[model samples]
Target chain A: MGNPAFDILSILPFAVACSFGMLILLLEVFQRQTASRSYLAGIAVVGFLLTAFVSGSFLPTGTARATFGGMAWIDGYTQIFTSLFCLAGALTAMIAPRYLQEHGADRGEFYALLLFSVAGMIMMVAAADLVVFFVALEIMSIAVYALAAYTRRSKLSSEAGFKYFVLGAFASAILLYGIALVYGATGTTNLAAIGQAFGGDVARGATGDAAAMSTLAQNAIVAAARGADVSVAAVIGNTGAGAVPLAILGATLILIAFSFKIAAVPFHMWAPDAYTGAPTPVVGFMAAAVKAAGVAALFRVVSVALFSDSFRGGEYGWVQIFFALALLSMVVGNLVALVQGNIKRMLAYSSVAHAGYMLVAFTAVGFRGGDISMGSGLVFYLFAYTIATIGAFGVLSWLGSRGMPCDNFEDLDGVGYRYPWIGLAMSIFMLSAAGIPPAAGFIGKFLVFKSAVAASAAGGPGSGLLIFLVVTGILVSVAGVYYYLRVIVHLYMKKATREVPEMPYGAARWAIVICAVLTLALGVLPGKLVNSSEQAVGQMAGRADGVYQQSAEAPLPTPGGIRLIR
Target chain B: MAETIFFIVFALGALGFSAAVLIAKNPINSAVMLVCSFFCLAGIYVMLSATFMAVIQILVYAGAIMVLFIFVLMLLNIRDDEIEAPRLSIHQGIAILAGTGIFFTIALSIAAWSGSSSRVAHDTMSDTFGTVEPIGDQLITSYVLPFEMAAILLLVGIVGAVVVAKKRF
Candidate 1:
């Protein structure tokens, strides 16, 4: 309402993505029909790189300021995730042209939709309002639904698309309903405003100290009563007489929607079909960028808006739900993945298990235990997982280009000796996915586990829960090894039962090489990434403001204290 | 007293037509019943003082979208033999039970819940709150971003339809 140009740079990533998407659409129309698909993909790559560069610039600043009338937060957390998403988009663009052309669905709309989805992801990471977040989510979901069904000629693809669209639409509706309920309870859609309402007078007092936090338990009820028009006594007694249950119910419903997006078990039934039927490159994009976007959105909501210490003490809580989902996702995703013969389906299930690992970090953050940073570990883990997934799917796409999709394990028999480089790239990706030592996956897991252990040691609420998750996570890693190594064994040990096609030189090959090298580098020298992640998470936590940063907004009460953002 | 009698009659008609929509054997009959249901619902909206919404209910749902539904039905033109006989399964029974349970729970809560009536009272509200001009003003201002985004979404939908349904691209 003030300056039209105020903080316009905050939206650079989204603006870049949107403009590029439209540019690609226009280019498709104006350019010759026979213009190389790779050229179009190259434009997309340039767009992503530009967006990444813009987001990356904010990393050094490490600011957590709100912009767009507080509808978006320009912060280190969003910036880093923005980079992760852009890198995924760039890689997808690099690998997609070949896959789309091979499948006879090469069209300008594919790249356009990819960019649009990427734009949506960018918007999601930056969104600070429920309305904005929901719109961004739909933007991403709709584009992805089309991408999943891009191969209209294939029945399997159409079915996958239809299933994903219907289910995704239902999830969106539920999410919207939850948003409506929360808005009803809190009377605001802005995360900051909601946090302030939840925090009440304690939040406004703005004294940064441990003593202030001791009073938080007592004051929190008063705050909830004031904010939500519910009685403090009723809330403390858990009599279900007020908006507390309604807020929790709303949050839980939203969490259910997020669980569906992250492919947590019980909500992960659609992933196998969608991932298997989608083109190889598009599946990789879904695994990497789409999952990252979902996690980003989930983290923002749970941490910034709905976070409250008292919410956990009640019979109904988000923490318990997260803990249960994490354990189930880990065990079920791994055990069921072990039985899958289709490689894409296996990877899809593997993505679910990976989501479980990130959820462990999410749970720890929600517990607000220890000195461990909140979102950095989750961000790093997603980054590492994205790299490995992209590389793995790149190998599949390479084979797909040669007219052999390698959909099932049998199709990859003896491919190792015949195509050693692709075999080697795929092996690294598998090893990384397995969380083996000296791979990016292991480093990501290490950081995540370290945070969980730290949280447990902090001797706060849910310590035992965090400890149990860490132990189970370690055990699940062993199970992960067997499935991942099985793929490697199929590569080297099994002789060629089917004719191994010659490895072609193209964007997919380059993408695989880049991703493999990046993954290995992340594993071997994770110091920089780890430091950056910690810094980003610390900034998100508001530690940079010399106050404890909990999941809530800056102007709201942290578990330890209140730090005003001025 | 007259308004109350009219309300009960309209509500019953809405419910009956809705049931007919669900229970009709022929697709054309179902479509007609759905139109009747929509009109009855619009009547309820008007009684509730949401005249704009009531008008929109008829214009959009009954007038435009229903035409599209009938056109598709006519285009398909499946023979009576082609339609499968309806059969109730355990799954359907469970779903119906769950739906009814939810409905009762909501109804009971509304009946039982107290102390929020003062908040629900909007007698102090602006006269133009639900009118067309205020809504248009807000849509062009506060909701401008979403409005633009929705436009882009529709454009994407058009592009998607072209790509998905076009025979030769």
Candidate 2:
């Protein structure tokens, strides 16, 4: 509260991206109508690089601090995800210009919207309050909706944009309603306050007879005596045991909304159509940065707000819900992907399967003492998945031209012989995505599944469920190998029946090479990223207490539940 | 007792108009029905002592937004025959059933919880509670981050509107 300037500085990465977005829009207005706007892509890449640079500076510090009146966290997890998003944005920008130019849709606003969306993403992962999270999510979704329809001349693109906007808006409404319910039950949108209300130890500390006073009523008395707002105190006191059901419903709604965002099964009907119809590079961004942001926010909210003992492992636990989603997304995604002829649609399903894999790690987080490694594994998997997906889509955009989109498997026939470098890069991406040996995806899967196995080995009540999830994940991933390898087969073994058009190797080639090298490097020497991810998750665990002190200011009267940082 | 009567009247009006909005076949009629629903909602808000919210609800939603919606409906210039006849498809039937089930579940839960001892009496609130000043103060102070972010959200919305609607760059 004393340092508003520091709060502004804490959001430097978001500000930098927003400024660049505005700069691009302004530049677009001044440019001649007939002139090429490809340089705008370069400017956007530069913007992303600066954003990454600013975020990266925070990585080594390993500090977790709440800023902006406790609305956002400047923490290792935030920095890591922000940097990852910037990388995704930079790669997408590099891959976009040539594709956009080719499709006669090369407008500077594409890069502007890309920057605006990335800015939103940077904030989304960093948001500590549900209000900030919702607004940032809208900023990201709105920009992406427009980006999906950037090629408005095409009916498919327009349809994709309209469908995504409608579904996404509906999901946002559900999320807002959930937030409202949680606020009604807890009387605050601050995540830490909600966590304090949900935590079990505070309920035990009340002086009144345990049977007479509800846990929420006890906490509300303690909180009110500690100088909480009267309105908040009143709402919390009134809800009593009823608050639990309301909050649970709210959390479930929020989880459903996030599942839609991450393209989990039962809510993933939009992914195939949107990915197939969107411009290629935009698809790469959606598959990479957008999914990463969704997963990041999901982890934050689940860990900070809903990780109470009662909430983590019971009949109504999120772990059980995530386990079902993971199983369904993996099985259904892999199975549906096998039947898809369009490469983009295939990858879209593959992305769903990858989300399932991430959820496998997410489910492990609920097991006793499994959070650090499982959380780190989730991060590493996202990094691996983001780069590999973007690279795969980059290769598709590279091989495409004005008339031929190069979306089908046949379009890739004998591409290995025609363009060896692009083919090799595509092979590496495909290999990584399939979780094959000597590739990043393999290491990511290994880390995640290994943690799940280790958690199972600990022999808890839900250990058997964790083992089942891991086994099911591994089996479904084996099914996933067929479609991923099919791309490589088309690249090398098959002969082209229809001649594939050759496009110039532009900045997209460089982006592909970068992704390929990073994929292999992470696979071979994952020590740095693995250690950093662990450090990030560790910071997250340590920072939960910091959030309480920052928001509440006065020390919480409850003795046992929270370790106040101050 | 008077407050209870007002609450009942506004609540029933809001729900009835909302259902009418859905049932109206003409696009213009539906738009007007929606406007009526908004006014009833604003009345409820005012009864809850949220004068600022009620005023803004009427101004932004009922007055301005409804006008724009009506303008668009007029511009589209659709005849009554152009509207699809209400048909109970299986999907629509299932959706309606699910909606009713959820509504009843929530209503029952609220009804059960209403008997709890800790209900906040309306007189407990401060005189300035729901006025604009306190809201503006909260918006600029603790909630400033989201307030600023909302501006960015609006900017993005505007940009998105132009990007999707513009025929040519």
Candidate 3:
């Protein structure tokens, strides 16, 4: 019953964040009521910095391994995402003290919940088992729900919390059900096992592919193919036809669940209200870190389980579903954002559009074996998005007070001239978000678009789809310019409507300056970062083959009460 | 013939109780009907020879959860007339259509997969696998992490309840 100390080292970042959170929560009770809350913020900042350092240290030097009986993984992908989440958490912590003081909701649990949620996000990225992933997702979601309602004084905050909880629970149920069905088909919940279950000739010998398989399986596969506009007859004619039906059905269910998490077009309805109603710093955390975790999970799950080699080059595939979702999200998100009056809501729609761009990159990976640069592009884009968004929200948090939050377009009128520093930073964020030159967002978008073009020009089976997405994505990004430029115009041209105190700030101001500088720096000198990102992705590509080798050596449990004795 | 009759009775009872829970205007009636439905579900579980699951179902769903439901219902003291029937609208109509479509699609998909060798066979179960002792052993051994996580989740639930329901710390 002793602890597995050696194995636990792989999860050092998660452990650090969780223990730091518990320490903060315990100290909150013993500390004097009159004590400055900034100390707690300082602890959170240290925790995040330490976690980021640990994650960075563990980045793949050329190896990838799953520990804890395949429940968690240590790899370059996990390292990159872990660092991003911790950095986001740190930045949010820096902004929270000022925002909470102005809003009259300063409490220790706020920082505790933020750290706990960051731990959950790190765990999510490291998860190698479906159950671990589900647990981590729930932990993150529950803390966020609590944080959303942290302000007891505001009815809007409570409403936002309740709505998000109800919708999130519904989505979680759908996702768990999908996991159950997949477990049913594959007889295992381990990502590698599920991947092996459906890949190549191995699937024919899998438990579910026996001659006694029901005709209904064929019917469902046909229905799925028809739904995706693929030829059902051609798919049924293939070898391992019996396994395809269940894989298709399970993947569809999982795709639906992931769509909600990523806030794709139709599932994005709750995002605006959730973002606008929460405290500004929490909104930034959710917008940046939460979105990063979701995207990472999507990539891991799709590549590790759902898109095995046998499922490729098929008449029907999950890629087509993702392609459709990405196309709709880009078109709808950009178009609707143009009319939003609330800054938070506009940013929410923009987040959805950004998810679309990432999905386009993800779908393109289905073509040409696996595009390492495209995958790395996704990581880079998310990092850029996180910094810019946190900065934008930080500026909003700075300008707002308890009674009169500067949320609307008119609220920001002439404030730019009044606070030149904040105005210039906000302008930089707006430019980055619009994919304008000399900004990180532009570089991010260029890399993603370039990947899509590479996939289409590679002349694969799904090249046409990638081509269409790339074209539409580029055009929609141009439309994204309109709303972003409008923010700039309002900041500079409009007259100031109200007078506000111009007081020197502490941590929040410093945080905003750091974010802006990083955004600009990454844009101006992208070489080193881009090279690291591609290297991380290269490590990922090599790791897939490594996983198969490891699984071969391990004793694998098969379906039908069969076990391999090594 | 006897097995078929038994299955039909259990299915009908469960479905009827579920329908009653949905249709009952009063919250108390709905709670009662839900308890009845849980019993029927436990019966179905027993029919599948998952005796441990059936016992847990009765203990957790029918007993403990129902008591909590009744406690909340009594505490709220909502008036009977306040629970009015929802009027049919375009939104409702579309929801119904979508629900039916999704249900049929899932049912068809499940039927196809089940007909194949994918149907998990309970007939081959090891005697100890379904028994209480082995289940307990496995819960403490292989599933110890999940069990501990569940304990933490319950603790969180308690803390959250205290934080939200209390007017002041």
Candidate 3 residue lDDT tens string, B67-156 = 999999999999867777789999999999999997887777666555644233454445554457656754554344444445544534
Preferred candidate (TM-score higher): 1 or 2? 2
Q: What is candidate 1's CAPRI-style docking category based on DockQ? A: incorrect
Evaluating just chain A, the predictions reach TM-scores of 0.87, 0.92, 0.89
lDDT of 3 at A393: 94
Per-residue alpha-carbon lDDT of candidate 1 for residues A247-294, written as tens digits (9 for 90 to 100): 555666788899999899878989999999877888999988899899
Return the top candidate by TM-score.
Answer: 2
List ranges where model 3 is wrong by over 4 Å: A1-6, A58-60, A200-244, A369-373, A498-505, A541-566, B1-6, B118-123, B136-163
Q: Choose 2 or 3, whichever is better by TM-score.
A: 2
Q: List each model's interface RMSD.
A: 8.9, 6.4, 7.7
lDDT of 3: 0.74
Docking class of 2: acceptable
Which is better, 2 or 3, measured by DockQ?
A: 2
**Where in model 2 is the C-alpha error above 4 Å?**
A1-6, A58-60, A201-232, A369-372, A497-505, A541-566
Single out the weakest 10-residue window by summed lDDT for candidate 1 chain A.
A557-566
Pairs of residues at least 3 apart in sequence or in different chains that clash in candidate 1 = A303-A551, A541-A549
DockQ, all models = 0.20, 0.48, 0.30
Candidate 2, residue A293: the lDDT equals 96
Taking the tens digit of each residue's C-alpha lDDT, what string does model 2 give over B58-165?
999999999999999999999877878778899999999999987886666555445533565676777776788767766776677889889888988999999899
**TM-score of chain A, model 3?**
0.89
Looking at model 2 chain A, report the run of 10 residues with the lowest lDDT sum.
A557-566
> Candidate 1 local accuracy as lDDT?
0.73
Tens-digit lDDT string for candidate 2 (A1-566)? 12232367888899899999999999999999888888899999999999999887744466666776567877888898888999999999999988988888888899989999999998888887788899999999999999999889888889888899899999999999888877765656767666666554222222222245444456556655555443444555544555566667777889999999999998899999999998889999998899999998888888777765444544357778888898899899999999999999999999999999888887887674325446788899999999999999999988887677788999999999878888999999999999997999999999999888987887978889888888888898898899999999999999854444444537888999999999999999999999999887767732334332343443332211111111
